[model samples]
Target: MFIEERKFEYWMNRLVSHFETVNRKIDKLSNTENKINDEVLLDNQDLCLLLKVSKRTLQRFRSSGKLPYKRIGKKTYYLESDVHEFIQNGFSKK
Candidate 1:
């Protein structure tokens, strides 16, 4: 009877350890997904800061189609790469 109880306790400990490992994996995956989403939603504010431009100028660029953007419902998002390309194009002599 004592041996059986010991075996049950060992299995319970193994199960608890497995649960903790799975929980950690889930937490890591969630954090990675959040980071990816944050990257995609990096906004005009970040672009303005990077380009040293005003909000009004940024809006003008958006209206003129000089800067491509993503419109998610009413929110506007700009990719960092697009902002860099815009700056590069501004410096181009064509």
Candidate 2:
């Protein structure tokens, strides 16, 4: 009985340590994603900021194919290259 209890306690300690390691790995991955998002934000500004247009204008542009975007699930994202190209090649000189 005594030997069985000791073995069980040792196994429980190892299991708990393994869980802690997994939690740390998850936290590290989450932090890395956040950092990447920040860098991407600098390259790709929000629709309002990039175009200096209102929400309605952005919607119109998307619908009319004036602005290209990537729709991920429910949210829309614009690439920096595409936005710049639209300004350089598509838009008429103002």
What TM-score fits each model? 0.51, 0.48
For candidate 2, what's the RMSD?
Answer: 7.5
Count of backbone clashes, every candidate in sequence: 0, 0
- Which sections of candidate 2 miss by over 4 Å? 1-45, 90-94
Cα-based lDDT at residue 84, candidate 2: 81
Q: Cα lDDT of all candidates, in order?
A: 0.74, 0.67
Best by TM-score: 1
- The window of 10 residues in a row where model 1 has the poorest summed lDDT is 33-42
Question: lDDT by residue for model 1 over 2-93, one digit each (tens)?
Answer: 56888999999999999999999999887652123445445767666777878788788888888888877786787766767777899222
Candidate 2 on 1-94: residue-level lDDT in tens?
3568889999999999999999999998876631224434212236587667777776777788887877666667776666787788755332
* Backbone clashes in model 1, listed as residue pairs: none
